[model samples]
Target: MNNNCTEVEDPYIRYVMSQRPFGWNFTDPPVFKPYEFEKVDPFYWVSLMEDNWKVAFYAAAIYIVAIFGLQKFMENRAPFELKKPLFVWNLSLGIFSVIGFVRYVPGFMLVLSQPNGFYRSICIKDGMDLPTGYWTLLFAFSKFWELGDTFYIVLRKRRLVFIQYYHHVVTMIVVWIVGPLVEPISRWYTVLNYGVHSLMYPYFALRAIGIRVPVFIANLITFLQLSQMIIGFTVNMTSLYHQQIGNDCIRYPVSIKAFSLVYGSFILLFGKLFYDSVIKSGRRQKEKKLL
Candidate 1:
């Protein structure tokens, strides 16, 4: 790995040095112009390696404790009460999720319209003047709000599976961190995700609102989640290749690779669980009926 970084000989760097002399000032003179921040090259990224190392440690600590600790405690505890407002809150989010889904379709088409075509999946869209910073900020903030899913699950005394809760919290943090940290090649993942959530949340919302959906529809949603993971993996792989080959596509950096690996693995694991719980169980039930 090249540890060498381009020394900031740009006028901006000199001005920055004049102010702080240490090259790490976060105040006035640096003027927070949108997109004015220096392009984060991979080599310079390691400079943050030490400072941000705590994020991983904290993530791991939370995952271990939550999986082994709070989950076990909750499992053995007395059954908790289910109330009305929580349902109402979930319904509201369901509404927002649907709205988010509508936005995703157009956003995705915008991505597809690029000269590289949809399959190529470039992060920085060409010929598309779509909202960049604000959209990213919204997506990041939405992940935080998604923490409500877990809160509701706990409050209603649902069995919080390790797969479910861990994925939610960790993903919430990951999405938040990655959105601004690395300008990924395919923003379509965000849009596709919103689309899935749109359908998924409404299903939850319907359940909360006391509307029974066919079991098949729920299964279908799970299938979509798996499909989303496949698409994401494909896109990330394309981005990785294009980056390495110097195809002018945006590079996803090391952190993105780590994030995608974890995310994709979890999705695959969850898909297996869903298959076991749904299809395998159904087959077993049919066998019992025949007997």
Candidate 2:
């Protein structure tokens, strides 16, 4: 529901907060406060990010270099059996992502609960709550932390696919740059990621501990990954469309288009992965069952 934004400093207004079904006051802007510190400015990282666009480029460069270097270094080395460590690594990430999903998803829903929520969901920046704000920052930095996934792969001499490493490189760069911005569409990014990874990493943790997960559960995660891409592409296009129609809240059309291209590529990548891992395999499994 599009209405005239109320103020220059804080634009949202809460005239009918009583009638709001979710009981969240949409009028007050959400401010991100750190977990236990009042000394820190809540918006400090966001301001820093605005001035440091090149940080993403530098981070990506470092990550790509490290991936290859590790791959080379691990050559001729006996693969380390790191069962306990790998289990801890995946379990920790899975737990962190679970917390993030809980903190962030509610705020995302609150933004969408508003009138014209779809537009606001794509356009408004301050719809996030205080906890979501903190978790968003953590999730951004965690991209680099999650690079350890490749470390495990390389050290264990596992087949490191191009998609595995490439996906990590791109996300680390993009999220480092864009995470603080917390663009309206990033609500979708943050939620889907935390939600999906809540299952994904834990699944890995189980496998790391040598537990066999059901085939359907594994397929569901892959399917959810594909769903995230399709949703990303759609949301970006919708935001771009709103921008074209002159919504000031939509802000950066260029960034929207760039994200669209990124999601478009992912759609193809994940689409193929889904077919090979799920659809095609499902057919073969069914044929086997019949026999």
Candidate 3:
């Protein structure tokens, strides 16, 4: 299905457009418009969620300090030992992941099915027309539930890596911030991530349940994360380029450069970590065997 607002064009283009598959709406010119009303302040939406931000930040801060402090002070804390509570946590995460994944694949296909324009699927002006916001809101709220991940580690006495812990907490904050603050690409990223997590968290859950999942299967989650980064970068880049050239005729409410940089950097960092942990470790082990 073609998912876009047909742009205003010359008479000849309009004549050709009349023969197109989907009917076109030719009332207004395809000029860029900010999401909010022209008179409304840009900060209004963000301000609505400021209270949520403060709470999330403080909670994240406390967790960070406690996790690190406990790691230093406690020597025997570890996730190696299996327990009933751990099993329950894993099962819960598995269920959540499954639900998340179910929504993601279809959502992704919808976005991918859209034609050339980056913002066409869920543009700032007419987002109501697309289903992106509904999924995004659900995905955003799910982050709050995911805060339990760190709690699981703390209870099990596992060493929470700085990156993983920080990524979790900060991402919760970021997703919440971006949800309503500005126009996001919406369901595209959320679906991809949820689908991956669907598989990933379940793997952890199975392991927690004393089911020895193959190492290769767990590695698939890492691969998915890397793929997500690549796709995310591609999407953001396309959005920025089209906006710059005015080809898409969509005006972003915020700085696409800033968004792209932060998202891109996140993918790069995570990609490096995966390589070091899995690929590099495998290579080193192989080298030792050769020696």
Candidate 4:
């Protein structure tokens, strides 16, 4: 890290330093480094996938074929009673989500507490390093594991909603592309996702274990999903506005546009899900009681 704040040419950094107290240097090395992967890069292969569009295309093709193929295969079969395995899977993912939230959020908060840390958090110029990088990489690869979510739906012979599959497909591609790039704003994406998954997976786990979860709790998760999409869209738009003004913030136009489209769609889909699951459902129940 450069100590001479005056020599830093990046407008974002300069702005950060300008907000500091006299003689304070925003360029000073941080007191703590974030967590990092040890022993080996667990995400090495996934990182390689980012190098070519063909890899993503191939993976996506396989994913689509497998989903439809499985659906066809199970057309005449009875639903699998996967209660025990489903419980384990959801519990594991919930734990992982909690771990991700714990590992990354403190570093984020530490940066945000610094002078102009809020701006630094959103427009980090140096890119992700240490534990945050390791976890962010893991977060990206986790999307592949998430594909199994739909598999459970298919094996259980449940109706697979278009929104559910669409979200899974786009997420796999987006994370693969954006994770390796390590845009600063990507922190928002990871943090919000981890936060949601932390709650969501545990809820699913409980249900899988035959614990009766309230319908409202499930509604809350969907609401959180909608909120995440809205916030993600807003963050991307903010970054684009900053880029347009030549603020010297780190910006990736391609990722921003892709996120806009994906999250924009999510807003509509989740909104509909929320209305159908909560509002419409509640109205029908009320009508039932009145009858």
Give the distance in Å from residue 47's predicted Cα in candidate 4 to where it truly belongs.
5.7
Best by lDDT: 4
Give the alpha carbon lDDT tens digit for every residue of 1-291 in model 4.
Answer: 343668867664444333322221123333355433422353454336433434555677888899889999999999998999999999999999999888778666777787877567667643344566567777887988888888898999989889978998898888776554456787889999999999999999999879999888998998899999999999888888878887756656667788999999999999998899988999999999999
Of candidate 2, the 10-residue stretch with the lowest lDDT total is 11-20
Cα error of candidate 2 at position 170, Å: 1.2
Give candidate 3's whole-model lDDT: 0.58
Model 3 Cα RMSD, Å?
11.7
Candidate 1 has its poorest 10 consecutive residues by lDDT at 21-30
Candidate 1 positional error at 167, Å:
0.8
Q: Roughly what TM-score does model 3 have, to 2 decimal places?
A: 0.70
> What is the alpha-carbon lDDT of model 1 when measured against the actual structure?
0.57
For every model in order, what is the number of clashing pairs? 3, 2, 1, 3
49-151: candidate 2 lDDT, tens digit per residue: 5445567678778877887898898897899899999999999999999988977777788778889888888776657555766677777778878888988
Supply candidate 4's per-residue lDDT for 276. 93
Residue 22 local lDDT, model 4: 27
Give per-residue CA lDDT, model 3, range 9-126, as digits (tens): 3442333233322221112222233233222332343334433445667767887787677666556644446456667776776676676555345534544466733467434233
**Compared with the true structure, what per-residue lDDT tens digits does model 1 show for residues 232-280?**
7777777777767767655446545755775588677767977887789
lDDT of 2: 0.74
